[model samples]
Target: MALFIFRSIPMNTYELDCPAVPFETVGKTVAQVVSRIEQRLRKAELEPEWVVAANWIDDANDSLHGLKADALWPVVVEGESRLCLSVAIGRSEGWLVQIDHVRLHKAGDGGHWSSVALLRIKTLTRTHAWAVAAAMSRLLEID
Candidate 1:
C-alpha cells in the first residue's frame, strides 16, 4: 500500500507591501534602480508571464535623454483587463513611476485590440520599486 498527501494553498493572501528588510539604492543610477525592481519582481515569482518594455530617449543636442521602463501584468479585476507599472528618468523629470489600469477594446470590427490607460498613481519615487513588485505579485494571487 502507498500513502499520499496533498496540500492546497489559499489564494489572494499576498501582502502588497515592500519587504521589511531595507533596500539599498545609494549611488545607483536609474537603470540600476530599474534592474533592482525587475529582480524583486522575479524573486517574488511574478516575472514569467509579465510583459516588460524599455525605451531609451535621446536628442541631437545631448541635452535631453533618459531611459523608460515598463512592466505589465494581465489581471482579472472588475471592469479592467490589465495593469502597468512604468518608471522613467527624463531630462527634466528626475525619476517618475506610474501605475495605470489598462483596458482593451475591439478596434472597429477589425478584430484588433486597442489598449487604453487609466492612470492610478501618477508619480512615485524610485524607492517605491519594491512596493510595485509586491503589487504585481499580489495580482497573481487573485482568484
Candidate 2:
C-alpha cells in the first residue's frame, strides 16, 4: 500500500526555456526582468511606460488600483486563453522559481482577472504566488 500525501501548492508551474528559445538577452536574466517590473511600479512615475497587468493604472487618479505583486498580462491564441506573463517583487530578494506557474481558473465575482476561456488570476504579493503568463506568439515562432 502506498501512503498518499497532498501538497498545498499547485503543481502546474511553468518554466521558461529561455535558452531553448532564441530571444536575445536584454542584458539581464529572467530574475532581473522580474525585479525591474517590481521597481517600476513602486516608483511614482506619471506614465506606465512598461506594460502592466492590463494597464490597471487609474487615468483620473493616476493610481495603480488593481496592481498587485504579480502584474499579469493575458493573451488569447487561436481562441485559447493563455497568460502572457506575470511579474512581481521577491520576498527576501529574488523571484520564487520553484513551481512558478499560475493555476488557470475562472474569474469569480468582484471583477477578477478574466479570460476568454473563463480563467481568473489571484495576485498574491507576500506569499509565493508570483507568476508570469507565457507569451504564445513569441514562444511558438522563433527566428
Candidate 1's residue-wise lDDT over 15-134, tens digit each?
Answer: 345444434534444345445555665675434222332333322221122223332223435553554556555345334444443455556655443343322222234444344434
> What local lDDT score does residue 96 receive in model 1, on the 0 to 100 scale?
43
Q: What are the C-alpha RMSDs, in order, of all predicted structures? A: 13.9, 19.0
Q: Estimate, for each residue in 1-143, the C-alpha lDDT of model 2 and write its tens digit.
A: 99989779643333243234533323443333344444432341211223333223323321233323333322324332333333455454533222122234445643334322111123333233332223222332211
For model 1, what is the alpha-carbon lDDT of residue 125? 43
| Clash totals for all candidate models | 0, 6
List per-prediction Cα lDDT, in the order shown.
Answer: 0.40, 0.32
Give me candidate 1's TM-score against the actual structure: 0.32
- Model 1: per-residue Cα lDDT at residue 133: 38
Q: List the residue pairs that clash in candidate 1.
A: none
Per-model TM-score on C-alpha atoms: 0.32, 0.19
TM-score between candidate 2 and the true structure: 0.19
> Which pairs, if any, clash in model 2?
13-101, 84-133, 85-133, 86-132, 86-133, 105-120
* Model 2 Cα RMSD, 1 decimal: 19.0
